[model samples]
Every structure is written in C-alpha cells, then in structure tokens.
Target: MKITPGTRSRATLATVAAAGAALLLLTSCASSTEPAPEAGGAVAEDCTPLHEFPTIQDGVLTVAAMNAAPKFHALSDSGPFTGIDATLIPEFAAENCLEVKFKPMTGAAAQLDLREGKSDMFGGLILKTPERAEVFAQSEGSILYETLGFTSAKDDAYATIDSLKGKRIGTLSGSYYVEPLKAAYGADSIEEYQSDSNAFEDLKAGRIDAVAWQSIQGFNFTDRDEDYVTEILGDEPAYPELTVLLENNWPHTKGNTEMTAAIDDYYERAKADGTVARVLTENKIGAQAADLYVNGR
Candidate 1:
C-alpha cells in the first residue's frame, strides 16, 4: 500500500491522542490509593467496618460528652483527654475500626444530643434505670455500686437521711439522687442544679445545707475543687437504708442495636484484657472499679 500524506497525518493524530490518554490513566491510578477524606466526612464505603455497628456517621463514632467530672473526663472541650473515658473511648473506637469524635455537652443536653442524632454515644455516670432504658440503648452494667454522699461546707457529714428533714438540700436533678433526696427532704424543699459548680456555690454560700453528690465526686470536693466536706452514706453499717446499689452505664442512641452489642462485647473484652483496670488507675479513680465490670453489675 502506498502511504498518503492525509493517512499519515491521521495516524499521527491517533498516536498523540492515545499517548495523552495513557498518561491521564497513569496519573489517576497513582492518586487512587486512600483518597484524602473531606472534613466531617462520616460515610466512606471504602472503610472496613470492624465492629459492624451502624454509626450516625458511618465509620465515625460521635461521643456526646457530659460535663467534665473528676476521673471521667478532662476539663477542656478540645482535650488532652486524660481520663478513663479519654483512654477507653479512643481505644474502643480504634480497635473497633471507628473514628471517634467528641461533642461537649452536659446533663439533659447530652442525652438529647444522642437522641437527636448529633452524636453516637454518651459516656458518663448514668444509672441503668428502666425509664432511661426505654429511651436509650445502653451497655451492660459497667459499674457495680456507686455510693451516695452529702457535701457540706461544715466539717460534719450527715450520717442519716432523717438528719436532713425539711432542710434545703441541692443535688443534680436527673440523677437518682433527686427522688431519694426529695423523699427525705420533701420535693418542695430540695433544689437541683445543672452543674456541680453551682451546687458547690450554693452549699458554700449557706443557701443550702448540703449538696447530695456522687461519692466519686468527693475527688472534686477534697481534691480538684477542694472546699467542702463529703460524708459517704451507703458504706456506713449503721445506715443501710441510705445505701443505693446503682449501676453506671454508657448510653447510646436507641435503635442502634448493632452498636450496642458491639460496645457490650468491647466492655467484656476490655475488662478481661485489663483495659478497664488500667484506665481507671491512669485517671486515679481507683483500680477496683474494675471489679464492677468483673462482677457484671
């Protein structure tokens, strides 16, 4: 066949176009490995679902934080994250193939955050009450028993529930402390504060006689915040009637059964592997809280 100028020109054009296409394909392939994710990118089909739990944001577990408390959380919003939750939350997320994020909120707002789909889990000292069970999905008993305490500016600790009859007392509202305090000191007489700081102020100013608080929160009074006198109630042999055997549970949003079961399994595994004990000790919360997990309370 005789070569023509027209045919040769067409062949050259095809060669250049083919060469450019090959270069483009090479560039695309080189950039394809683990593409950079956008900010707040919750769902990524490429991600391996390690725990098989469906998150509000796929591959990301958003934690709704209750206000910073002694031993549970660090004080800052963007955290050094140096507490039991600080350690264990990341550990749970990391090992289970979830990217953990935290949203700082407190009290009723935190629970509402989880319910409203703004976050995935709520890790705090929440009691496993039947009423709460109806609204949220929760981990199995993560704590055995949490003792109650009465905090007063005076050195003396209230020994009996009867001691506070008709006296103005303050405590956190949603906590189990409310009903019990109301029972002893009539509903109208008791005042509830959203944060411990406000309650401490009331107790300090003499507006309230005492603040009924968690025995764990003794860390705040004797150490962290350091002013009040805390009298541990339930542990005393004389007032067994004041004793409350309450279990602290981690509450997730309801209907996330897969996440709930995955978290439950993570708790058992963490307890068995000494993660629970180690984390508790790191935050100086006493290593024995691990027994709560072991006892399955």
Candidate 2:
C-alpha cells in the first residue's frame, strides 16, 4: 500500500486495536474452561444427596443388661429390662429415631456380648472400672447413682454386717458386689446368682441372710413388696457408680462415630439446659438428683 501519514496512521491504529482484541479473546477462552471432572466421581453437580445424621429410621440399638433390679431388670414381659437407665436409654435412642432391642445376659456373657457386637451397649448403673475401660466405653457422665447396701426381709434377725459374717449373703456372679462380699466374709462367703431377682428371691426364702445389692432396686423391692424391707448399711464394698457402657471402650470404634456424636450432643444439650437433672428426678433415680455432668465435690 502507498504510505500516507494521516490515512496510514488511522488504519494502523484500528488494525492494532483489532489484533489486541483477538489476543484478549483467545486468552479469555483459554482461562475460562476447566477440564471435565472424572466420570462417576464426586463433582459439584452430581454429588449424592446427604441424609441427615442421628436419623435412625432403620438402625437397631442392641442393649445388653445384667438385670440389676430397679436399676435395670427384666420384670415379667411387661417390665423386662426396664429401669432408670434402661428407660432413659430408649428415650435417647428414640430421640435419634432408632429401634430399641434389649438383650439380658449374665455378667460374663454380657461382657462377651459387648465385645462380639451382639449388643451395642449395656444398661444399668455400672461403675467405670479400669479393667472394663479396656473393653467398653463408659458414659461421660453418670445416668444414675446407686448405693450398694444390704436388704433383709421384714423381721429378719441379721441387722449388722458382722451378724452376717458367717451367714450366707446373696450377690451376682462376676459383679462388683462379689468382691466386697468376698472381702468382708471370705472368698466363698457369697451365694452367687446369675440373676439379681433370683438372688433376692433366695434372700427372701432365708437361703441368704442379707442381699448385698444396689440400693435403688432394694428400695423398689421393699417399696413394692411389704415382705422385703431394705435398710441402708454403712457403705457398700466397691462403691457403686451408675453409667452406660458401650461396646467399644475409650478410643471407641471408628464406625461408631455417628452413635458417639449423637450421645455427646444429647448430653451437651442436657447439661446446658438442665435436662440431665430433670431426667434423673423424673425417674426418681440418682443419689443427689442434680446435674451429673457437673462437678459435685
């Protein structure tokens, strides 16, 4: 083309502007598009719907219990394995929308059931023992406070622990009370029973002098039946503390994260809003009948 200063300048300026626009468009196109996400993989658009947690519509909660009377026991078909802790546990499970199932087992069997996943948790006011801490997870706070003491039938002769030194004492096999009975009398002093109700029956039948058992059950027994009367003795052998026991102990199971989180959330809300103490009081259970998660001493 012929070189003309004015016409060439205007034409070059327009051409240069058009070239710059083309480059900008190419850069924009290159920067805007990303590689397609992997097929059948996680993506912003194709993510599976998230189901709400603690929604136990189809989940089953297997609870194992030793049936320790008023604390937890199977009383006929109507009240089998229903006590302070037993009842409360169902409430919690229902709160999480779970189906409740109870399995009453002997002490040794209960331990086995816990480890083998036959039961998700155990019922009653169990003490958090170091040995048990290895196999089971204890509740962060106590659900019930049970006193260990002796109960006697009305007009029974035995009044003191010394009086029952040589007398037969009824207790559960592989229970915390067994050690105390053994310590007080001798290794073979106690008449061990797999069931607390059976032991209490034997006690009423005069097969045993005193039934060393949890105080709440003793109270329930004496209150419901006039024949059996329970009195609080000095103190129990191994100091009873009532708490829930899970199948997995301290570290807990990796799969049980949902269950554990639900329990923790329940207690956290309970502690914050006085529901913890209210639950205890409503059931007429626990010693102090106050917020258990808080420091009492």
Let me know the TM-score candidate 1 reaches against the reference structure: 0.74
Model 1 spans with C-alpha error above 4 angstroms: 1-50, 74-76, 224-227, 235-242, 286-297
Q: Candidate 1, clashing residue pairs? A: none
Candidates' RMSD to native: 21.5, 28.2
Pick the lDDT winner: 1
lDDT of 1 by residue, 1-297 (tens): 111112210000001111111100100110112222222223333544457777887556788766646534534554433445544665566545566666655667888887787888886556677778888987774633455667775454565677777788888867767876676568988898887778877887889888886655544554333345565543435444346556666788898888777777767766666666655554455333334323523
Clashes of 2: 5
Q: Write the per-residue lDDT of candidate 2 for residues 1-297, one digit (tens) a residue.
A: 111112211100000111111100000110012221111111123222122243222354566665654455554322333344554555555444344555666666776767776677766656555666666665454443333546677676344567676877887776666775687788777788877678778887878887776545555555556666655444333422311211211222225656666566555555466554544454454333122223222
Predicted structure 2, TM vs. truth: 0.62
Q: Whole-model lDDT for model 2 versus the true structure?
A: 0.49
